[model samples]
Target: MRVDLFDFELPPERIALRPVRPRDSARMLVVEGGAAPFADRRVSDLPSLLRAGDVLVFNDTRVIPAQLEGRRGEASIGATLHKRIDLRRWQAFVRNAKRLKPGDRIDFPQGVTAIAEERHADGSFTLAFGGEEPVEVLLERAGTMPLPPYIAGKRPTDAQDREDYQTMFAREDGAVAAPTAALHFTPELLAALAEAGIASETLTLHVGAGTFLPVKAEDTEAHAMHSEWGRIDAATADRLNAARAAGGRVIAVGTTSLRLLESAAGEDKVIRPFEGDTAIFITPGYRFRAIDGLMTNFHLPKSTLFMLVSALMGLERMQAAYAHAIANEYRFYSYGDSSLLIP
Candidate 1:
């Protein structure tokens, strides 16, 4: 389909710079399948919205302080580490990259530094950190949270974002970006979901900086998704399959979870154990073998995420839903309001 079909006007003020206090206070827009009227709700109402025995799959990948400002002599460079090739090395999108080349050393804060080992076709560099202190440790000392450009461009990332950007489920550390939808969940909400008999499970998908990239492709077919590492163990897969077999719905908490689940599901619709990288590009024509619903933040115009939601619900349905969201003043983007899309 033409990418232009997904385009819409969004007022700049609609973007959320920070989350509401007591995370669960954020508003949620419930969009049902077909011609159902869109419902205005709050994140705290999620448990009541979902049925008993439904499984909510969350991404447990933790966000690292991937944004680093450094210098090679007089040239200032900024790097956002998006993928980890190994313990000591990462693939990063570097600003001031025009001044860098393979084998240049960049000096960062806290005495941390890295060597630009290889430059990829996409202009990202493979950076190898110096010394033996774990890369996470170095990042803690030298880096700041990798805020989405939409937000970062508006203001600086302050200390508050360190906690606000992370979800309650964050555990495995690797993701450059946070699974923003999950950030709305709170301990109180978890207890409510449990009381409502709504089960939850976790998997890992290290969200990359690629999520922030604009879709320059004119058509959906031409767009290529960036690969991000994810994992689902045998036990989790078995549990998910069993839940589905028992008539429970599998609700992915974010596109990250939905994409990973779809990647692991066989044509038979059974999820299997999976590990490694995935560049799953979900478009309107794509068939969803897993996930009965999706809970995610509002996305950018003409973005792959909007395309994914359009695929989950029909294109016309999503277009209308988004129109309702905008008209109702729902926040947009990573730090925005939430939406529970059931199809």
Candidate 2:
């Protein structure tokens, strides 16, 4: 399908710059077959909406404060870690790429320094940190949360965003972006879901900086997905398969969870344990085997994420949904409202 098919008018002012207070206070729009698929509900009502036998799968990957400011000689540079290649090497994007060359030494906070080892064709460079402390620990001291460009313009990340941008279940650290769907879930809400007889499991998928990168391809099919490391453990797989055997639904908490599940699916549609980098691209003709439903935040217009949702909800339906969301003053994007798409 043409990428333009996913295009819709989203008012710039409607983009959410901050999360709603109490997190779960966000709105949820349910799009299921039958009727017009226009239901008004709160995110807090999620537990009650799902059936007893359903299994909720969430991405436990935590966002890192990967955005850092540093100086190369006298030139100041803004850097964001794209992904870690190993203990020391990382692929990163630098703001002043034109002035940076391979073998340039940059000093970070806490006296940590790195040497640019290689330059990629896209202007991103590889950096190898020189330190004994874990790179993550170093980043914690030197970096700030990597907010999307849209949100960054509105305000700087204060104490509120330090907690608000991440999910309550975030554990394994790597993602630069938050799984916005999981942002709406609270500990109390998870407990309520458990009390309602719904089971939950977690998989880790370190969302990459590429997620926010705009699609340069005019045709959707021409686009290539950025690789992000992900894993589904044996325990989670067993529980998910068991849920399927018992005729239970598998509800993915976000697109990250959905992509991980789909990437690890076996021949029988049962997910298996998987640990590797995945660059799986899901466009309109992609058949989903593992996820039954998706819980995701509203996405940008003409984005790959928009295409992924269209694959499940149908392009025309999603276009209509976005129009409704806009007309009703629903918040949009990372810190925005959510939707439950049952395909």
Report each candidate's C-alpha RMSD, comma-separated, in the order given.
Answer: 0.7, 1.1
Please provide, for model 1 over 1-343, each residue's C-alpha lDDT reduced to its tens digit, 9 standing for 90 to 100: 8999999999999999999888998999999987889999999999999999999999999999999999999999999999999989999999999999999999999999999999999899999999999999999999999999999999999999999999999999999999999999999999999999999999999999999989998988888889999999999999999999999999999999999999999899999999999999998878899889999999999999999999999999998988999998999988899999999
Name every residue pair that clashes in candidate 2. Answer: none
Scored by Cα lDDT, where does model 2 land? 0.89
Best by TM-score: 1
Which residues of candidate 1, in runs, are more than 4 Å off?
Answer: none
Q: What is the TM-score of each candidate against the true structure?
A: 0.99, 0.97
| Global fold similarity of model 1 (TM-score) | 0.99
Residues 69-173, candidate 2, lDDT per residue (tens digit)?
A: 999989998889989999988899889987789999998888978898999877788999998989899998989999998899888877778898899989999
